[model samples]
Target: RVDGEILKGWPTPTGKLEFWSRTLHDWGWPELAIPKYIKSHIHPENLESDQIPLITTFRVPVQIHTRSANSKWLDEIAHTNPLWIHPIDADRVGISKTGDLVRVETELGYFVLKSWITEGIRPGVAACSHHMGRWKPEGHKGQRLGISTVALNQEGSEWSLTPRKGGEPFASSDPDTMRIWWTDLGVHQNLTHAVHPDPISGQHCWHQAVRICPAKEGDRAGDVSVDTGKSQAAYEKWLAMTRSADRYSPDGTRRPYWMLRPVRPERDAYHLPLKTESAEV
Candidate 1:
């Protein structure tokens, strides 16, 4: 059993099976084995129905799959989780640029995040790369270079490095010691995820459609503004449908499932709703 339903054998779900068959048939390919009892659930009516919401997975540059993104060294290479949206969609909602903060909103909820507007995504749909933003304490340590190097000058009997205010030279070695500061710490962008569900799988997609906008004047940099009334309501709706325990088989052991586990219960409130805003680019 999976998701409280029994799967009798090794056949693809009715919906996916039909899609494959139709796709093959339309392309002039051979028809594959499709069980007779399993009705073709893909109908023009269903395709046109409102049941299916936009579905997409996120991708980022620095991380490979889920494993590397969690490593300290790799995280420093790319710090933020950027949302990818098509230019047309971005234009429709007012998203402007790669660095601009944008909000994406759906019926279930909304989130505010930095936008990476491009033509890669399909119009009316957006994507966010998972991994990237990470906040582990040790990870913070890797962000800044601890010690710096400096240049020193030696003139006749006098040798000096740049002096600190109200103090002697920062350091004076046999060869003048100079100091310079450097950093390797990168930004974490994963804080923008919110709880949203896919209608078909009854599983949370963890991404939300939203609008993007500039931080208001005098607003702290990186702070997002969310409508509490809307966010809270959306969260409650998701909570109602989420399963308390992992799905299991009829015999009580865990079922063979292929999906990622939910990270935690935290949502961002700063994103704009898709219908209300346009891409700023």
Candidate 2:
């Protein structure tokens, strides 16, 4: 506090909090400068009649990022990530009961997971808890607690993750390794998720609008199918929404002075002209 008074300031272009962002306006985003209801790509009104919003941002209380997936104590409480669908919506998708297999389809491809019918989530929305699916490629160094070793097959723009061996009882130097029993490690849905980046905030849009349907004949648990071609298209679509740095950096600087930098570079290094020339080699 300055002189024991309350001090209030924010990290905006303005010294104080900004009601309208001048930086956004000057970057050719005048429409987004003011705070108002901007419709998301998957907004309810914008969604097609058959589509349901898939909320991918929810996290289980016990886990923190992907690291805690290897924690035996945490995995015991919450291990599997079932697709949470309301009973009404579950019926529409032919999911009769909890634990039934369901395929959630995105623009790129699909992932099969168990169904969880409940009134806990909204009727028209489906949610899969974040950070449950953690896998390691076969022959790669991996943790034993909560990760499964898998074989990754790639053909052109398509990728698939198949389980090689799940966590099982085995003789090891550590006695606790034999005590491990649970094997229902969740599937990695993030692999199939197409990136939808926010133009202004520069954040990947996590919420998706997906088609919920019954699992196909060959679909298995923990299976992820992705066509990288569609993923690349989604990335380019969002990238085009953003103003080009080459065009906007009239002052020769890459970004605004107030923007946070982890390690501040030399002043001359911030100039794009000099930086571009050095990269030519």
Candidate 3:
């Protein structure tokens, strides 16, 4: 079967390969109706002198953190998430060698982790796999296979997590617990990440503009600090970026019906609710 013609020109409303979106134009995003690159929050012009773009968009194998049928071998292979930094950035940040602890400061706060200085990554960007930072609070029961027990503390809106210890062999019912050897399980970097939803696509933007530096005097690897208040503030900041659909639906519909909908509602249900006196409120 042909791709376009067989479907009578793609499923889109335009019935053609559209570089421009009529729905977007009528639904409050005229400038973004055409395909274009909007500067991200981490764009060079948007960043400070010491800031660099941190790419947190990718994930590692599920076995690195999540249970894979409780298979012990998968957990042994891939478990640590180190910050991938180019040698140039490494030297610039005073990371003399690999495994040196580094602090990656974000809009809300920072997380510390061992650095893996390598040429595998871009010089100007830092990357950490989101897969391996699984954690459990201090005095809380957590899986021993792929997590670090951490001390969790909170002061008003600010919160901090410090790994009390990394993975170590522990006596338990399972014999494999004694065979466990790895220590670096990774840090919880997700907490420090601020929310920034794309105005048009509505997908969460995962790229972060951050400051990378050598770990501070008291900083330990797998340490994370954040301000919940700042995280909430960031959510609102990106929320304001969106153009409200109710104000600009050309046909008073919630969204373009032509697009794929996993759970499609009745045609009439797509229309905006009747504007009552309270609707304006």
Judged by lDDT, which candidate is best? 3
Model 1 lDDT per residue over 23-112, tens place: 223222333323243222222242333222233355666676546633444544554555676777666666666767664444432334
- Stretches off by above 4 angstroms in model 1 are 1-56, 61-73, 105-112, 136-202, 218-281
The full ranking of all candidates by lDDT, starting with the best, is 3, 2, 1
lDDT of each: 0.41, 0.83, 0.84
RMSD of each: 18.8, 3.5, 3.0
lDDT of candidate 3 over 102-219, digit per residue (tens): 9999999999998999999988999998767778887888576777888889999999998887888888898888998888888878889998888777888999999999999999
The alpha-carbon lDDT assigned to residue 200 of candidate 2 equals: 76
lDDT of 2 by residue, 154-262 (tens): 9999988887776676667777668878787888888778898888768889988899998889887788989999999989988989886678764767777778878
| Candidate rank order under TM-score | 3, 2, 1
Q: For candidate 1, what is the TM-score?
A: 0.41
Off by over 4 Å in 3: 1-7, 60-70, 266-269, 278-281
Best by TM-score: 3
Worst 10 residues of 2 by lDDT: 272-281
- Which pairs clash in model 2? none
